[model samples]
Target: MDWLRKLFSSPVPLNDSYHLSPSYKVFTSAFDQEILAKDLERSRKYAGEPTASADRTWRELQQFWATDLALLQAETTRLAGRLQPSLNLPKSSTLTLLIDHSGSMRGDKIQLAAFVAEVTVQLAIKLNLPFEVLGFTTVEWKGAPVRDLWSAQRALSNPGRLCALNHVVYSDFTDGDHPNSLRAMFLADLLKENVDGEAILWAVQRAKAWSAGPHMVLIISDGAPVDDATLFHNDPSYLWSHLHEVIDEFGIDPDVLLAGLGINYDVSSLYDTSDTITVFEDIHAKVLPLLENCLRKM
Candidate 1:
């Protein structure tokens, strides 16, 4: 598995605008499907600690956000006490946030995500709901390493998803009670390409395994899937089409309730329950209402 990770994890130069030619897919190779084994699907995915030093990144958030976070905690406390119990989640339900850590989420978007994380924690605590804060991004900028590996094997057209899938457990269930768990969202370096379809599928699969009766997952992202490595080799709509398929398949399941939050991006196309993506500039953004709307289905 370490070898597999190395194959996909290595960074290399890539052409951003590379797209498949009409003839590219006409010709196929044995290596077209994957560069390695049947297990690349599992081996290429990572969900663990930040590649950077945790202590340093956590302290960075601590120093920069001490006052604001304190205020946020106080506000959440106030809201929790006054809010009607109807706003609380259904009992025995679990919540999970499948966030996009794409490069486009870098500056203000990422910062707001941390704020969202704080709010989610507050909601979980107030509602007595178990939750997880998870994120997804590629290991590197493009699929160059993956492509290079495939080329080394035998160049082929329509090779899907050359980059390593990185799913992050920024804060797992029960960790909401801990102070530093959300700090994983503050790591700027973890922000990279987003493959929303796979991330959503992974989150949904994990959530389904965790609970039988009720579970709610909220996907937060600023944009659609944009992994250059994949789009270049396959159809331009390859990832987007897969995203729609995954959502359409499980979005309406009886046991699971799913909603999407577009961070200033229009994700209404992806999730029928999700409205247009908006920034969390103020309480007026209806962030809480959206969460309430999703959980209401549960």
Candidate 2:
């Protein structure tokens, strides 16, 4: 809860000068370190400079860019004609997007979350995937609230429409005395109050109704949970431990339901050297691949 509180309360300043840091480049995927070690040992005699955009990294980069829904849908449609079920499983029917607005993500984190949310919705529409859009912070709304972007196709047609959606969705955040901690608490409370739980429930309901199909949930965040003294009352792991139970209650195979976790472009330790881009890359290299591993195991 403390983690969530900090996320909500301290929104990052969007207008601040933005730059990509080199730290992101130095880091590698979960398989990167081992693969690099093996390749280095094999080629010790050659001593040639390594290419910047290796094949593996190029594939990941392609996947990242393909996340843009219109392009993805067009490509998928073109390829689906030649592909058999053995090679290409049909796209899932339902998708749930969860963005964590927790702790010090006020500026960059929030912006990215909102951007991804918009893309996820567009993809859902393009593929005719029934989808739910959810934003997680500690805040509560009346009734079982779900924003239906059924018209997401229409909304995404404009060039800068995604940015406008982000502004309105995140504008609800009010500046607080302890903005960082308060934001974290919002996310924490969301977990505690079963907001995410309810979303999971609806997802399972959809999956069961379809009988045999996959469901996806994509989560975007900078992994730090708020570590507030007062809000969490210091019991930090309380919510994370409940995540499995929440899945179990839904009666869905944990591994089959896809979950994509994205790390944002920010590093707390970047102050030492003004290389913000490097910091973001460093954190992404360390964290994203780790997260991918965990998701695969699930």
How many residue pairs collide in each prediction?
0, 46
Decoy 1 TM-score against native:
0.74
Cα lDDT of candidate 1 equals 0.64
lDDT of 1 by residue, 1-298 (tens): 4554445433333222222122222111212221111122223232234423434565676578777667666766665565545554455578887778899987667766766777767777776777877778866677644655656655555666666666767566655474354555555465789878767766776666676748888888898799887788788987887677667767557777778777788777777677543454442355666766776777
TM-score of each: 0.74, 0.38
Model 2 per-residue lDDT tens digits across residues 1-298: 4433433332222221111111111000111111121232234431332222222333443356554535534543543333323233344435555555444554444444443444444334444455554444322221111111212223222111011110002211121111111121122122212223323433345444653445555544454433222113223443333333454443345434545344543423311111122222332233233322322333
Q: Which regions of candidate 2 deviate over 4 angstroms?
A: 1-92, 140-213, 224-231, 244-256, 265-298
Worst 10 residues of 1 by lDDT: 29-38
- Model 1 residue runs over 4 Å out of place are 1-84, 87-91, 174-176, 275-280
lDDT of 1 at 293: 72
